[model samples]
Target chain A: MELLVFLIFAFLAVAAALVVVAHKNPVYSTMALVFTLFSVAVLFILLGAPFIGVLQVLIYTGAIVVLFLFVIMLLNIGREDSQIAGHKAQLFFALLGAVSFGSLVILALSSLRPKVLAPLTPELVSLKALASTLFNEFLLPFEIIGLLLTVAVIGATVAARRPTAEESAATAAERSIETKEARP
Target chain B: MNVDVVVTVAKIAVVLGLLLQVAPIMVWVERRGSAMMQDRPGPNRLGPFGLFQALADAVKFLFKEDVTPAAADKPLYLMAPALALLPAFTTSVVIPWGPNFTWDGKEYAFTVSNADTGVLLFLALASLGVYSLVMAGYASNNKFSLLGSIRASAQLISYELAMTVAVLAVIIPVGSFHLTDVVAYQRTNTWNCLLQPFGFLVFCIAAFAETNRLPFDLPEAESELVAGFHTEYSAMRFAAFFQAEYTSMAALSALGCTLFLGGWSLPWLNYEGMGWLGVALGLGTLLAKVGVCMFVFVWVRWTFPRFRYDQLMRLGWKFLLPVALLNLIAVSAMTLAGWL
Candidate 1:
């Protein structure tokens, strides 16, 4: 039963991932990306990582993808330009990058044993055990990641802050001048 | 195995049946309660105390013509209402309706799916709830609908941060994300509302925003946005959005009851000692608590004036987020000091 479900979702994830890249509309591509993420989450649950699965959905599909959708709609992003196909050299470089990344992943996986890779033991993936492992063994990396996220958030806030009073006044003056010119 | 499947099916049936009933009945309450507050007769002409008013509205919704805009994205337009209802139905399954009971020598949990990641599951669904509004607005091909959805997306996402952290304030001391653990913790330590009033306050306020109730309901502010995301919808489609709103209100209220109000664990009510009678008694208590929450939802809506868009954003981010974080820290400190 588990294998069957895994196969179904694995196929779904692959198809959705393809759609994410290939879809013409950016908004539709984001929706397809949600499907891919959700399928991956289901795969995580199948692997006895329900906590990770839920987090995957919570963080990726729920939060990040929603933001992506918001931007796509707010900007009214249109279909992908067909002119991208004109760049053969760029396409060659992209394939070269993809191949190198795939090879690197394969090389990393080759050194790991199957049992070591995914133990599939409930104890390993359970919330308490995961928390202990993260805090004890991976605490530095986790804290560093948290710090990185905080810094990024602060940067974003600083970048998106309201313009100064003079800046707004200048813009208002510019709009008034443009309006006056159009009226004449 | 057969019994397990049967029990799950039964639990789903009961939860869905009760949840679906909450929508129509709450609409009745909203109308009648608002009318009573204003010294009016309300919809008493339909049936006994206007009991059948919801039914009449449902019938009218079903018969009304389902209109689709010429430029609307057809598939998404059709899917939005169903999407809206999905979270409402799914989030309630983790909520324990009554205490566990043994029948036929087999123990059965009151909830439908008592998964280990129950709270996380609820949060995931809560995060996705905005999609329906976004989809509705984006697909509608109408400016108002699009703007409403944009506001909804931002508002829900912002409030979700505060709500999730506020919930964690309670869950931190409990040391588990399980709903049953929450109820059990409350049973031992008077209700959580008394213990962490700040958490409760932040949670209730965030819950109001999460469910997009009034004061925070800028997404569908009728005067400004002309019915918001569902402006282009009509007939049963519009009804679906309306029902989704009420159903979600019921879900969030039930969640609040579980999180803060001791769930089915009523004060001076020892259903646990009542032997087999605890099952029915526990369910009754929970329903009653949920009923009170529902009334509160209506009352707050009628009582509060809607907040301006920036004010709503400011409240969610500047006020609620910081307060929820403080509550989390306080609770964590108390837990560490063996106070909680």
Candidate 2:
């Protein structure tokens, strides 16, 4: 039963990822990305990491993908804009890069010892256990990441702040001059 | 094993049937209830006191033409309604309706899936509910629909933060993400609402927004957006959106009851260890609580005027989010200090 579930979701994930890249419309691609994220989340649940699985759906599909769709629609990127500008050479290089990455992953897996792994016990993936480990063992890295995110948010706010009064007035004056020039 | 499978199947059928039936009935209730509040008669001609009005509406919707606009994205236009409906059905699976009861010397739970990660699953599914509106709006190839969907996405995203924080506040006292555990915790102590009134208020407001009920129904503000995201939808597709909204309302009510109103537990009564009778009574209590919550939903809809778009955004971000965060911190502190 577990294997069947895993296979189904794995197939779905790969298929959806393909659709994400192959779809002509950016909106379709974004929707396909949501599908891929959901399938991957199911795979996470199957692996006994239900918290992580839910987080994947919550953060990626629910939040990030919605933001992606928002930006896509906000910019009104039509089918013409969605089309890739490159030719056969770009496709060839992309395929080569993908093949090399696959081979590298395969090689890494093959080098690992062929020993029977311990089965997932409920305690191993329980929320309490996961929380404890995350807070205790990985506390430093977690806090650092949190700090980095705060810094990034601050930087973004500063970057996107409104122009100064002088700057805005100057821009308004320039726009009026351009409009007057065009009126003639 | 066969009996277990049969029982499980039967349970699923019954729960789903109840949910599907209740959503339409709730629609009727909302209409009638709103009419009563406004001192006007509403939908009295369809059936006895207009009870079967929803059924008639369903029949009408089924026969209506399923129109797909020429400029609309065909596949997405078709899929949006189903996407909208799926989360409501899926999220209900984890809600425990009653306590376990022994039948023929075998114990069975009232819930479909009593997973430990129930609360998280509910939140995850509820968050995905945004997709339906977004897809519908974007696919319609209409400006109003697109604007409505953008509002919906923004509204949902903003309100979800406050909702999650409020839920976290409730979780602190219970110290468990499982709905059953939360209920069980409340069985001995007071309801979370009594303990965390601010959290409950925040959650209730956020739930209203989450379900897109008035006065938070800015996404479908008819005065401006002309029916919002479903402007281009017709026939069963439109019905699907309608049904999904009611189902989410039901789901959120059930969730709120479970989290803050003590689920199936009645005050000053022990329903456990009494077998089938207890199970039945527990289920009744939970349903009654949910029904009351549903009534409150209707009452609030008729009483409050819809918020302006900017006002709605400000209320969610500036007001609710900070209060919810503070509630979370206070609850956490109390829990750590052994005060809760």
Candidate 3:
């Protein structure tokens, strides 16, 4: 039953992913991406990581995708215009990226020992176990990732912040000096 | 199916049944409560004390023309309302509304799907509710509708951060993501409101913002957006947003009651091991707490003036976010010190 459910959602994820790529309208594309992300989240649950699955929906679909939609809406982007001349370059890069990712997946799979993981049971996959694993084993990596996100947030804030009056006045003065030099 | 499967299905049925009734009950409460606050007659014409007003409203919504705007994107416009309503219906499952009971040598959980992630699933589903607003606005092909959706989406996103952080405050001390664990923690000690005052305040404020209640309802302000994202929606479609809002209000209230107010828990008593008596009393206590929470929602709506759009955004991002973060840090520190 779990395998069947996983198969169905995997199919949906791929189809919605294709829709995300192929759809003309940005809004529709984003909505398709939501379905894809949601399907992936179901796949995560089936993998006995319901915590990560819900986090997938919460962070990616909920937060990131909403930002994507927000940008699209605010910009009022219409349907993408097909650029025939750009197709060749795009196809080349897409194929190159896909082949590399596919190769990486196959390599990782072959490198792993067959049946390395024990069969998942409810008790084995409890929240307490997950938390201990995260905190004890993967603590450094987790904290680093969190710190990286904090830096990114700070960077975004700095990049998007408007100029204060003094800074604007200094820029104005620089511009005036440049004009003076050009005139002289 | 096994007994567990049958029991889970039955629980889902009961919860969904109760959730479906939230709209009418909340509608009545909001109208009458607002009426009393405003010193005016509310909808007493439909039935005694306006009890059947929800029925009349339902009939009106159902019988009226389901409108499709001339220039609207037909599929998405039609799709938006169902999208709006789905998360509202589903999020209630994560709420542990009643106590577990033992009967006939079998232990039964009160919740339908007591998944491992628990409350995080509620957050995920609740966050998805934003799509309905955005889709409704965009598909409406009207400027006002689009603007309303944009505002609503922005407002929800801003507040969601604070809300999530505030929720983390509760989850931190409990050491589990499950709502049942949260209630259990409260029962062992005091409620989160008494312990984590800052988190409770931020959560309550963020809840108001999330539900698009007054003071943070710039998105749906009549003068600005003309009924907001559902402007082009009519009849059942319009009622879908209405129902979604009320149901989400109930869901959030239930969440707050569980997380902060010690859901269904009485300070003076314990319900465990009391079998069916525990179930009845626990359920009643939860419902009563939820009712009080809903009353506070309506009371605040009637009392407060709406915040300006910029003020709303500023309050969410500049104020609530910081306070929620600080509260989380405090909770974490306390937890580390074994104080909680």
Error (Å) of candidate 3 at residue A132 is: 3.0
Instruction: List the candidates ranked by TM-score, beginning with the highest.
Output: 3, 1, 2
- lDDT per prediction? 0.89, 0.91, 0.90
Name the TM-score of chain A in model 2.
Answer: 0.76
| lDDT accuracy of residue B105 in candidate 2 | 77
Ranking by DockQ: 3, 1, 2
Name the weakest run of 10 consecutive residues (lDDT summed) in model 3 chain B: B100-109
Using DockQ, give the best candidate's number: 3
Instruction: Estimate, for each residue in A30-73, the C-alpha lDDT of model 3 and write its tens digit.
Output: 99999999999999888878888999999999989999999899
lDDT of 2 at B229: 96
lDDT of 2 by residue, A1-184 (tens): 9999889999989999999988898888899999999999999888778889999998899888988888888888999977665889888999999999999999999999989987878988899999999899999999999999999989998999999999999999999999999996
Candidate 1: residue B269 Cα off by (Å): 2.6
Expressed as tens digits, the lDDT of each residue in B152-212 for candidate 1 is: 9888888888888988888988998889999998988889999999989988998888888
Candidate 3: residue A41 Cα off by (Å): 0.7
- Compose the digit string of candidate 3's lDDT tens values, residues B1-340: 4877778888899888888899999999999999998999988997789899999999999999988999999989999999999989899898998888764579877887788788999999999999999999999999998888889888999999999999998999898888998999999999999999999999999999999899788778887788888888889989989999999999999999999998988898978768778888998899899989989999999899999889988998899999999999999999999999
CAPRI-style class, candidate 2 = medium
Better candidate by DockQ, 2 or 3:
3
